[model samples]
Target: MNNKLISIALTGLLASTSISSAFGTNISIVGRIQAEYSGINIEGFSSQTTVNDPTFFSSWGIRAFEDLGNGFRVVTMIDFGFNTNGGSIGNREVFVGISKDSLGTLKFGRTHSPFADFAGGWTIDPFVYTTLQATGSGGTMIASANGLGSGSYSAVNSVVRFTSTTFNGFSFAVLLMPGDADKLEAHLGGHLGGHGNNIGDTGGENGEWDVQFAAKYVMDFQSHKLEVFGGYSRDNVSSAQKKITAFNLKTEEVGRIGGVWSYKNFSLQGQYDFISKALGAATCSDAAALGAIGDVSTRQCNTAMNPGGDGSIWYAGGQYRLGNATLIAQGGMTDANKTDVFASRKSKSFTVGGLYHMSKRTNLFGGYQHVDVIDKNSIVDRDRNTWTVGMRHLF
Candidate 1:
């Protein structure tokens, strides 16, 4: 049944691309394909390095738009990623937007948050989501109740976003999420009210409302270019919070800041993420105040009892380009000692690589990376070494 639906969808796209020309719509096919020999090495676990998957796979998208008289137009882009080695489509998305020359562009559908965009989406790190990330894969490897290898794609669904046209190299955007499994974050505490005057008087659960804001500026220094970016966001817990009888728990707030610089053929980039601020007041602990609002007591509401602390992750990288070849290196770390009872658990990784451009649409690359992870509970450390060489082509 699923295969049938997919075929219909692809056929629909092809049909639209063919007929849209009647309305003077410009449609284009765009994407890239990268094939590589990727391998990994670990201590104790004799998992030797092997060519598993490349840094990227073959994928293409269709984007179309038609000018509507004035400086306004209607646009739509549908894109997805697939594994050529396995013959499976992994990430798929579609978005429609209305753009005007004077105002800005408003897009509605599944899309990336402003944070991911400013950071370069899947390619945010030096190794481009392949390495140098928290759990690698651009930090997609998250530990959840489902398992320890949960892969979180970067795209967010049911989102409406607006990006202002650049003005004086300054641009800003706001992303509104209707909450459909896109990194929900719930904060505890209000600014003026609370069950027990916690962290500035805001105590109980802050609404399940989520919002994110991003701003950036690019400056030209004649000899070089500098771009600075910053983002702020508030999220609701997870499905667990919604299942917490009446009141699970939510984090307070989260934010990030970073910048990048480029001079001639050399560039540098880095960013820091401020993990959730578990500032919720455990109302269930003070039953007299929370009443049966907490209905059935659960660990989700035991925010205070849990490892409540602020966590942090940071990455720094630089690359140099000479002629048609480029060199890259980066280092990153994540510490959850403050938020997890298993305090002091941390991980760090380093990566270096080189890429040679064969043409405007093709490139050859090779790289190596190493990661060290410390498990607080087992007091055991795990290490991973990775290497890859691949070819990429764009159309």
Candidate 2:
């Protein structure tokens, strides 16, 4: 069939089907578009600014389901991402799965891990996925991307995922990804290379498994609510017999604890993470912004420069809603590995912002962030200030 004919057929099917019918198909189109005017100033460097969509924010997708007999349903999704500023379109999340009311939901495909989705993730951050988010930009969490052995991006690939039904305010989730065979090529760049492979050597992978596990609990009262969560994620990369790089990159591990409390018009949330062998995004960004490319070879944000050491990250924020607007304040710090290789990789950042509700599916948001990074080893101590004002619309 021609492309236009196929689209017409699908649209007709969607319009004719009864979404609530037990034996009929239900389909949904979902997405969001966001744009912002952003500016950044780095200490001792020229300022840069742009009017565009920030990273990982603009996307669109389709979700559909067919109800089967005996409480079973077939579900599927295909999502893609794009930059409003300038960049090639890319895949976001895609999956096929089955769900049952009493049993739970199980899926196989590429998507976010349990750690970054359910257990204790961006939910705690009011401005998640925005320029002021605490994960990749604020030094409050490990910025794991989808690589050969990585599993902590906003979405991951080749995953087997399961989430249990909530029972008495408790729920859990798990994700497993099998590693690929070693190409036998030397990886000298680092983790998350240009081709999304290992740029630097750290041995190679051979049928190893990466996993994530998480759980959450909730308590609700008439005007108050509370949610507590915890999770752990691991990226394995130590199966090959040959090790050929100096970056000493090993398996990455992260443990997180966090919760959110809401009472009437005020809400508070926070999270803390213990990270091993995974570089902090804030530290890496600071290095790159200061023109210290040598500090971060090949644009690998999660490279383990000091494989034997560990660090911690913590963030806290609160917001108050008044009529049509909400005010926000948040900040956090990342303490890098204590080894001499990263003795000065510590960073502290804070953000202040507000959101104005234009309607149920649209809002106006703006925020300012201040970040300071210390790198005694390279004598590159720098400070950065960023501000953004944007509007987001959902459909």
Candidate 3:
């Protein structure tokens, strides 16, 4: 009887140890690669250029999770971006979070905003070639004004966020950041109904804070699907002599509303943005205390401010599967408010692409995109195009 009791106790101890080891931890790695060719055309210029190169690269990520049990977990992910064109590694994302099935998830670090989730769902091009790329948020106008050679505004860094899991196909998310907390208590000031700019008047600090929120719903009925996403973002800038001298503007709010619908193999998506104190309007002189053409204009500045001078974008795309191959086509347009220096700039692009599946884990692809820009003022005219051929593998 004594031997049997000892044997049972040992079995129970071993079982408990195995369960603890199995439930306590997990890890994973993820990645992607891409390649492309690009070309550019400027209005009134006689050059149609070509950028043919082995561009785009594979990016990898390391992710881990710890199970706290009782419906709770701790998670972390780190991503490294590699340049196939330049042969280098880039740090992309680093974040940590605590998650509970019932309570939701809270994360801190650099991550894509809820706004990206709402705005990115409308296209068939994972690369956004034929449609406005996620980085094209400011589009051509802001790109030109800022002298940003390759115009794209896809992500923001240094954020704290909370996300709620899907509840009946509905969910919500919010992101926040502390602007120049050490210099001025602007977050507290905004909470107390004090003007954000006033908190740092007379050169206190010049950093800015951004807040964004989004809500989404996705419903499926057999072969048909519907998705609706909307978001708002506000950015407050501290008052400094540089800001006052550059744009005569201090703070801004930008809001977006959009949705997508799909049936069988076709989909359509649209989005509109209202910007307050538009950033495009602020202009700087090329040379001070002398006569020279400034980089941007005041008209562009005022247009950036007018709420009526908002921007709207729309796109429609379709895909048809043909025995291990899929043919894809998409077109999109962006209309900017005339009052916006960047608003008067308009663009339209179309693409035809295809994907060939080599197996469940590998694929080959190619696509062509043509883009045109319409300029209100002849001072700047930009027309660009690109072609991309790439392969992807998954494990």
| Best by the TM-score measure | 2
Where does the lowest 10-residue lDDT sum fall in candidate 2?
A: 1-10
- The best-first sequence of candidates by lDDT reads 2, 1, 3
List where candidate 3 sits over 4 angstroms from the true fold: 1-24, 37-57, 118-125, 129-154, 181-208, 238-246, 280-310, 338-343
lDDT of 1 by residue, 14-112 (tens): 322334587699887766565666655555554444343332235678888989978999988887766546655444447899999777889997655
Against the unseen true structure, what C-alpha lDDT does each candidate score?
0.50, 0.61, 0.45
Regions of model 1 farther than 4 Å from truth: 1-20, 48-57, 119-126, 129-153, 180-207, 242-249, 277-309
Model 1: how far residue 294 lies from native, Å: 31
Q: Candidate 1: lDDT of 263? A: 83
How well is each residue in 240-312 modelled by candidate 3, as lDDT tens digits?
3223333334454556666667777555555555555433321110100001122222111111222224455
C-alpha positional error of residue 36 in candidate 2 after TM-score superposition, expressed in Å: 0.6
- RMSD of every candidate to native, in Å, equals 11.6, 7.5, 13.2
Runs off by more than 4 Å, candidate 2: 1-24, 147-153, 183-204, 238-245, 279-308
TM-score for candidate 3: 0.69
